[model samples]
Target: MLPRPPRTVQVLALWAACTATSLLILRLGAADTGATPWAGPAPSWGEHLRFWDAGWYERIARQGYPAVLPVDGAGVVQQNAWAFMPLLPLLTGLLTWSGAGFYPLAAVVCLAASAGAAVVLDRWLAPRAGGAASLWAVALVWSSPCAAVLQVPYGESLGLLLVCAGLWLAGRRRFLAALPLVALAALARPVGVPLTGALGLWWLMEEAQARGTVPRAALARLLPGHEVLEARQRRGLLVLVLGAATATAAWPVAAWLVTGRVDAYTATETAWRQGAAPDVLPWLARSATWVGPHLGWLLVLGVLAAGALVLSAPGVRSLGAVPWCWCVSYCLYLLVFFDPTSSVFRLLLPLAPAAWAVGRAGTRVRALLLVAGVVGQLFWVSWVWDRTVQMTWIP
Candidate 1:
C-alpha cells in the first residue's frame, strides 16, 4: 500500500510509533532482568523496593513520631524529621488500613492521575492546534520520564497532574479555578514556584501592554480604563503568588508541626546521597561531557530541539522573558541541593510542558522533535534501570 499522507495518518502513526518504541526500550532494559516477584533481597527487585523518599514516607506512615531518645548527650528527643509532607503517606496509610496494599495502591493512583493529565493536555491544546499536534503532546507526556513515576510510590505523578491541570485552567483565563490545583502542585513538588512565576509574568506583560508609551497626561485621558486593567492584573498576581507560596510551604509546616525544627525537610535531604553543587559552567561542561562517547546523535537532537523552541515557536518567544527566567531559576535550584539523576528528572518535568507547547509549531517538525525526545529519554532510562536492577540483584 502507498504510504498515507502526513496529515491524514500522522496522529495514530505517531502514537503507535511512540508507544512501541517505549515498550521496546522497557523490554531491552528488562531483557536480562527477568521478573523477580516481591522485590527481592540482593539490591535487586527481591529486596525491598528502592527505598529513598519512599522508605522515609512509609516509615512515617507506620510510626507517626519516633520515641523519645537522648540526642548529643542531651535528654532531648529527636522526632523523625522526614515526616514533612504527610499527604502522600497519609493517603497510603488510609489505603492500607482499608485493606489495600500501599505500593499497589500508589501505583494505581499514579497511573490514573497521569492518564488524567494526558486528558487535560489534549483538551487544552486541541482547539489551538490540529488533532495531530494534540496527539503528539499527550504521547510525549506519556512517554516521558513521568511514566516511570507510576511504578514508584512517589508524588511525581500527582504533582504533574495538578500542574498540568492548573496550566490548562490558566490558559483559559480561569485564574480562580486554577488556584487550588496549583496549590496542590506546590505541596507535591517545589517546581510549582516556576509555574506561578509564569503566570505572574503573563500578568505583568498584560499590564505593560495596557500602559501605552504616550505622554502621561494625554495617555491617562485617552485610557481612563488603565486603572481597571492594573487592578485586575494585581489581583491575578496576588492569587497566583499567594496560592503557590502556601502550597509549597505546606510540607515544611507539616514537618515543623511533627518536629520542632522548621528546616527539618532540608536536613532530611542532606541525610540522603547529597552531591556537591556544580557551578553553572561546570554543569554545562559535565552535560557536554556525555555527548560524543556513547551517543552523539542524541546530544545533537537535544540541542536541535532546544534550538527549535528558541527560534521557531512564537508562543515560546512570546513568553521568552518568563521562560528563560524560570529555566535559570530551576537550574540554580537543581545545582544547589540535589543529586544528578534526581535533579535531571525533577527539573525537567515542569519544562517538558513548555517544550511541548513550543514543539507544536508544525506537524513534521513536531513529530521529529517528539520522536527524538521520547527515544533519547527512553534510552537514558534503560541504562539507569539496568544498573539499578543489577545492584538490586547483587545486593
Candidate 2:
C-alpha cells in the first residue's frame, strides 16, 4: 500500500464527503417545505418545490421576461428589481426545454456544476499549497454564505464555475484565455470585477517573484520564524488591465440600457437601499455588523485575530497580498454596489487560492474555522428555509 494518500484519492474523498453532507443537510431541511413526489417526500428535498427566487427564475425560464408586474401600489418591472440577471434563467430554460422539469433537476445541475468548480479549484491550488490544504480551501468556499443558491435554479453555480476556470487559467499564465471566461463570470455576477482583479494581482505577483527581486532578508524579517522560498514578483499589470477591460466590455451598456443615463445603475441601486461608501471606520463597523449576523462571533474573532497573526508571521506578509486584495475588493463591491444577495461573490468562490495561503501559518486553526463556517451556514440555510415556509413574505 502507498505510505500516504494519493492527492487524487484525497480530493475524491473530500468531494464525495462534502457532497453527501450538503445533500443530507439540505434533505432534512427540505422535509417541511414539501418536496416533489418524484424526488420522494420522506427524506424530502428542497424547501418548497417552488421557492421565492426559484419562482422568479422559473417564470423567467418558462415564459421569458415579463417587463412589468403590478406591485402593492405600483407597477414594477423586474429590470428595476435586479433579480433578473440573465444567465441563470437562461440556463434553466435550456434545461427545461431539454426535458429537465426544474426543482430537483435544477438543484442537481447546480450541485454538479458546483462540485466541478470545487474540483477545478482543487486542481489549480494543489500545486501551490498541497493536497490537504487545497481540499480544505475548496470546502470552505463550497460552504460559504448563501451556498444554497447553488441548489436552486440560480446562476451562482455556473457563474462560479466560469470564475474558477478563469482563475485557474490565469494562474497558469494564460491570461488571454482567462479573459472571456472572466467576462462570462462578470455577466453572471458583478463581483467578478474584484475577483478578476485578484487574479490579475496573483499573476502580477507571480511575475514579480519570477524577477528575483524579493530580498531573502526582507522575507526573513516578515516570516521571522519560518523558512521561505526566495522569488521575484511577476508582471501582472497587463493581465489586470486586460481582465478589467473584458469585464467592462461585458457590462458596456449598463448605463444606456438599464437607466438611460451614464450611471443610472448606481442610482437605481442606492435608491433601493442605503449603503455606505468604503470609508475605514464605516467599513469596520459595517463589516462587524455583517459578520455578526452572518458569522458566529467566535468564528469572526478567530478569523480576524488569525489574519492579524498571519500577517505578522514569517513568510506570510507577501502571502497575504492575494486575500488582502480580495477582502478589499469584496468590501468595495459590497459597499459600492447593491444586492447583498447578488451572485457576484458567489462567482468569486475561487478565493481558495488566497485562503490557502493564509492557511499556511496555522492549518489546524484554519480547518476548525472552516468547519465552524460550514456548520453555521448549514444551520442558517435550514433556518431560513423553514422561516420562508412559515412566513408570508416572498423573499
Candidate 3:
C-alpha cells in the first residue's frame, strides 16, 4: 500500500482540485449562456474573476468611499459605496497603487484568505473531531456552492479567515491572542458584532458548567459566599468578553465618525431592501408568497426548529461551547435580520462549526452528502454565475 500524504498536502491538493473544477464549471456555464467571462475591453486573467459584488470592491479599490452619501428626493440614503467594508478595499487599493490591477489583486487577496481559512478550520476541528473529519470539513467548505464568492474580490473570505482564526484561538483559551483577529473581523463585516455575542454566551456557559451546577453557581457568585469562578479564569473571561465587545463596536463607530450619522451603516444597509424594512409581518407575507399560504408558516416553523436542533445536537455540542454558541447565534441572526434569499447560504459560511457536525457522519453518509454538495455546487454555480453576468442578481 502507498503511504498517505500529510494532512497539509491533502488539504491543499483538495482545495486546488475543487477550485479548478469550479472555474471549469463557471466557464462552461458562461459558454452555455453566451456570456463573456472577461471584465474589461482588454481581457486578462483577472477579468475571469470579476462578478457581482466584485465590481463594488473594485470600485472602492480604484476610488475610495464617497465623501457624501447619495440621497433620493425623500432624503432616503441610496445604496452607495459605504455599504461595503473597508479592509479588502484598503488592501486591494494598496496593491492597485503599487501597479497591480484591482481585479487580479483582489482575487489574489480573497483566494489567499480563503486558503488560510481552510487551514485554520481544519486545524481547529481536528483536535475535537479527528483528522478525517477535519479534512472533510475543509472539503465541504470548498465545494459549497456559495464558495464561489471566495474566488471573487469580496471580503467574505478574509472575514471568514479572521473569524475562524479567532474562534480557534479562543477555543484553546488564548483569549488575548484572539483579540486582534476578532477586531479585524468586525471591521470586515457587520456579522462580526453578533460573533462577539456568541463568544460571550459561550464564556458564560463554560463558567456555569465549570461549577457543576449552573443555577447554584449563579446564585453563589451573586451572594459572594462562594467562588463560582476563580480569579484568573474570571479575569481572562472578562478580558475576552470586553475585548470582543470593543472590537464589535469598532466598525459602526468608525462609520459614525466618518459620516456624522449615528445610523449611517444601518441606514445604508437598509437601502438594499428597496424600502422594505425588516419586519416580521413582511417577512411572513413574503414567505407565504414564495411557499404558499398554508405551508409557508409551517415551513418557517419547521426550518427554525430543525436549525435549533442541529446547532444544539450532540455532534455540534461536542465541538465545544464556543462553536455551539456561534452556530446558534449566527443562525438566529440570519432568521431575524436577513432576507431569505440565496445570499443566506453565502452568509452561513462563517458558521464553520456546523460543518463539523456534517463531517462526523459515517463514511457512507459522508460520501453521499459530499456528492449531493457537489451537485448543489454545480447547479448553484451555473445559476448564480449566469444571473450575475446577466445583471439579474448579486452573487
Clash number for every model? 14, 16, 0
* lDDT of residue 345 for candidate 2: 42
Candidate 2: tens digits of C-alpha lDDT, residues 309-374: 644444333433444445445544444443333233443453444666644547687778777767
The global C-alpha lDDT for each of the candidates, from Candidate 1 onward, is 0.54, 0.55, 0.74
**Candidate 1 structure quality by residue, lDDT tens digits, 1-395:** 99766642454455445545654565555554443443332333312233344555556667764433223344332334353455566666666756765655665565556556666655655555446556777666656653454345667667767777887776555678888888877766666556656666556555555665344454334323222235664576568767876777776676666567765555544444332223333334445556654464566457547655553355543333334334444544555444444336544665545554554677777667666666665644444443443433111
Sort by lDDT, best first: what order?
A: 3, 2, 1
Top TM-score: which candidate number?
3
RMSD from true fold, candidate 2: 6.5
What is the full ranking by TM-score, best candidate first?
3, 2, 1
**Over the stretch 42-147, how does candidate 3's per-residue lDDT look in tens digits?**
2234555676677777777677776667789999989877778888888777665567677888888888888888888888878788888888877787887777
Model 3 clash tally, residue pairs: 0
Query: In model 1, which range of ten residues has the least summed lDDT?
Result: 40-49
